[model samples]
Target: MRILIVTNYYEPEEGAAAVIITRLARYLARQGHQVTVLTSAPNYPHGRIHDRYRGRFSLSETRNGVRIISTWLWATPSPRISRKFLSQITFMLTAALRGLTLPRPDVMLVEAAPIFTNLAGVFLSFVKRVPYVLDVHDLWPDHMLTVGAMTERHPAYRAARWLVDHTYRRAAQIIALTPYLEQVIRGYIPGMDKVRTVYSGVDLERFRPGLDDAAFRAKHALGNARIVAYIGTLGTAYDCLTMLETAFHLRDRRDILFVIMGTGTQQQVVRDRLAQGDLPNVRWIEWVKYTEIPQAWAATSIAFWALFNHPLHRGAVGTKMYEALASGVPIAVALEGVVADILRESGAGVSVPFGSVDALSAAIRRLLDDPAYYARCSQNARAYAEQHFDAEKAAQTYEAALLKAA
Candidate 1:
């Protein structure tokens, strides 16, 4: 089988979609399928193309038997609506043009976010007469509204909805990252028997228990303090301000240390708060290599996942939570819906109401102060990861779905 994956981001870029798509492409190639990825030059989170990929219209590379073709797109650091829309539109046009030159595949699997990328896949599928699968990572228009980027009555929102509905109806299959998202898709295109919920799993080999905790702690000079970590993009969707408030609430506790390890548009806001000299117990580290994530997990006692309360977020299931489980660390999440339900079902962590700094601080304290409960949660975390979130198993499921769509 020949599989063509269309996405906005790919390897050397650090994000959940990049990791998932790379893993899937590699796994499918390992299974004797010809896999190729069509993506934009690596410029995400920071919004500037990497030095190596700059000034190039298109470039191609291969990694582990998978072909990667990167096309050009506008780069801007501003999170303004116009800049973001321009970036998406440029990628959509370039990717569609590039797709026309490629060999027609048995199936086309596309990462649908920013929504506009789906246009490339739809156009290619129509021209080539190949079945296309819409792999939805996030629901747009709704997400834009949640972040105050647009309103329901806005012309842009209405146009996005029309485009999304058209794509959903035309897709041969829809791959949703969470059950809630699957439900939402089904609601949009009712009686579509093709939607499936496929959770993004973690790499068990790379992110299991028993890392060099001592070395990590020593390197960071975290002397005998309990570490609670929030390790991912610090973007608008996340309530990072609440995390800062939680840090302030626990600032007097010398034994508790808060570590935030990522960068995004909201970085300056957090930096300003830290500069106020009120969060001495808090520490911020810029993004690290993906390989070094295990070390970060090793130094953590509790993993924190925070998101702003929004209806759009109800369907979100962050990759960080699965990574934390794979690392045998308990979770402390401040969000509702799928993630909270997972904690409740697996007994692997505790959850609190979103935006409640007091509750967030209290949850961290409970995990730190209660050894017996902590041990149980830690054990459950690893067990859950092994049973439910293995990458190879997810790849197999995806392979079957793609084959069926083809």
Candidate 2:
């Protein structure tokens, strides 16, 4: 099969979407399918185009046997809503135009976030008379509303809902990242037999135990300090402030350190709060390359995951959780819904109520204090990751769906 993947982000972007997309594209290509990706130049989280990709309207390259077509986008460092919306719109228009110039594929796999990319997929599918599979990483409009980015009365909200429903109806198949999201999609497009749940699996080869933790610790000069790390986009949906509060609560315990590594709109917010309060127990690092993530994980005793307390986030699962599990590092997540369920079922870590600093702090302290429990959770974490979140298995699932859709 000749497969074309359309997404707003791709390789070198250092996000879940980029990782998943790149993995699937390579997997499909290796499976003897001709896979192509249409995406914007690498500019995400930080929002500045990579130096190598800058000043290009469009470019194409082949990586790991897959063809990549990157187009220019309106880049901005600020994570403001207006700037993000403009970036998405620009990518949508340019990607669509680029799609028109490409050879028609057997199937088109569209990443649905920034939502407008699906519009381009729908158009291309119709024009080329090929089936398109909609891979929904998150539910738009609803997510926007949940994040307070849009209200019901907002014209954009109504328009987004309409666009989402239209795209769902037209899609040959819908891929939901979680079971709860599959249910939500079913509700939106009732009796839709095409929706399937394909989780964002972790790269087991890239994230595993036995890395040089001592070297990582020595490199950071984090002598004897137990590091609790949060590595991902510091976006609006995440409650970094709550993490800071937890840090403040545990400041008296000199052994515990909170390390936040990522860049987003909330990065400055975290910086400002830390500066004003002079929180010595916390450390902030800018985004690291994807290749360096395993070292970061090695430096962590506990993986900290926090999401804002919102219904929209209930169905979502962070890709970092699986990465932590794969690394044999226990997780301390502050969120509810499927992620919480996973922790409980897998016994890989502890889950605290979202935004509860007391609960989060206590959970962290408990794990650190109880060596036996920490060891058990760490062992369970790797086991659970291998059994449930293996990247090879996920790639096969995606391949089957794309083939069936085509």
Candidate 3:
């Protein structure tokens, strides 16, 4: 089937949304489907447009057998609410207009994030007379509210809720990233039979155990130290403060280095705190290319997955955990809900209560001190990824969802 995927994020962005969507597009293309991606130019996390697409309003390219069409957005690195809202609005308009001119496909898979992108998909679905599957990554205004970005009484909050519900009503089908997320969406839109859970799985081929980490370690100036890494967007939903505090508690261990990578709204906050403190064992990397992330994982001895203690974050099983598991690196997570459940069920790592620095620190120390336990967790990590987080299986499930919608 010919498929058109509409997402604000795409290849070269390095964010979880971009990586997941890009991988799915390539997988479909490899399976002999005519896959086309409609997205904004590569500007994410950092929010600065890539050099190649800097001055262009729109551009198109083909990568790995999939066609990628990108349009310009009002990109910025600012944390202000107005700037972000404007960015989304511009992308929503540009993507919809650009998508209208493209050849109609059998199905459109729309990633519903920033919420506005769904407007583009809805417009294209109505105008092109094609079915579109709404891939719901997060519940929008609820997430916004949870992160204290806005209140329920805020006009923007109400507007976002309306837009999300409208998209949910319009789509031929909806894809939730986790089963728990699907349940919550169903609760919001009762009797929503069309929604299905398709996890944001990891590419085992790209991330696996036994990669040479010496080069990675040498390049990072991290000689022979076991790294504990928090590698993803340092977004508002993440408890980065707790991660740092935990690191501070373990600063005496010179052999275990804490590495924080990626960029987001919370990056500056982390930087400011680091500047005010004396955490010699922690290393903060502003950015890392997506291609090098597997090697980053290779150099990591432990993966730190953290989220704020918020109800909205309960269903989120962020892509980093799966990637870590795939790389055979055990996790020390400050998480709840589905992610915490996965850690326990797989015996891949230990989960501490959100924001509990002492517990998190202790968990790390135990994993380091007990070689046999660490080895078991590492083995379980890879086994779990192989059994459940296979990228091929995820792509097939996504394909089935789109086909059903079409």
Candidate 4:
């Protein structure tokens, strides 16, 4: 199959979307499919071009057998509204135009991001008359509304919704990561049979335990403390401020340490709070290489996963949750929707009510009080990740979906 993947974010821009996309693309290519990615230059979180992509123009390259194509576009990577909106539009236009000139693909898989990218993809599919599958990572304009990142009444919100609708109506099939989102999109788009659930996956082998027998602890200064680590984007979407709150709550627990291992819009603010509050049990670290996560996981006694309080959260199944489970670590989550469902059903970890520090405290204490219970959750976590959220399986599902869409 000739597959063309369209996503705004890609390599050098570290996140769940990038990780999953790269994995699927490489796996598909290895399966003997001709896979091509159409993406903007990689600049994410920090909103500037990554070192590899810096001073680079639209270019075609190959990585591990898959064909890589990046187009010139604005990617401000920051949280500034105006510049980000403009970047979205520019990348959409550039990718759409570039995509149009290529040979007609057997299937076009367009990621739903920046919202505008899907709009452009919808347009391109109609113009090219090729079937396009819509991969909904997160509900956009609606997410913006819930996070107070933007107002629902704002023109951008309305415009983004319209684009979302356009893509939905045009898509041959829709893939949603969570059941709540599947229902939401099916409700709004008037679809039923075309939608399927394909979870974002984790590399179970790479994110597994026992990698930190000894070398890892000394390297990261894990010392002797029982570490609770949070590793992922610290964006508004994640609402990680309460992580500090959790740190403060555990201030009296001298043997426990809270380690934050990532950067985002929320990083500095959380850091400032930690500094002013003088929480000696807490430690801060910049974003670690994705490869180093296993060591980080080895250092952690528990893994923390959080999302901002928003209606949009009901549609999210955080990739961090999946990865933590795959790493065989006990999870402490403050999230809603599918994540909560996974925890409850799989017994992978404990979840406090979203945004409640007191609840988070109680949950943390519950796990710490019983080591056997924690180990049970750890076993369940790894078991559930392997059984349900395997990317190897999902990648095959994705291939079949694209073929069907085509």
Best by lDDT: 3
Which ranges in model 3 have alpha carbons more than 4 Å from their true place?
none
**Model 4, residue 153: displacement in angstroms?**
3.2
lDDT per residue (tens digit) for residues 174-247 in model 1:
88899998898888878888898888799998898888878767766777778889888887788888888988
Which pairs of residues collide in model 4?
47-76, 47-77
Local distance difference test scores for all models: 0.87, 0.87, 0.88, 0.81
What lDDT tens digits, residue by residue, belong to model 4 across residues 1-406? 9888888877756677788899989999999999998888887666777677666657889998888888877767566677778988888888888888877888899888768777777777788788999999888778777657778788977887887887787788899988888888888877367888889788888888767636666776768888888887776777667778888888999888888888877776876887786788777887777767777787777888677777778677777788888988888878777788889998978887788888887788888889899989999999999999888999999988888887
Q: After TM-score superposition, what is the CA distance of residue 114 in candidate 4 from its true location, in Å?
A: 1.7
Clashing pairs in model 1?
A: none
Better of 1 and 3 by lDDT: 3
Candidate 2 lDDT tens digits, 156-214: 88988998899999888888999999999899888999999988789898899988767
TM per candidate comes to 0.97, 0.97, 0.97, 0.95
Candidate 1 stretches greater than 4 Å from native:
none
The clash tally of candidate 1 reads 0
The residue-by-residue lDDT of candidate 3 on 138-239, one tens digit each, is 878687787677898999788878878888888888889898879988887898899888877899999999988877788779888899999988888898
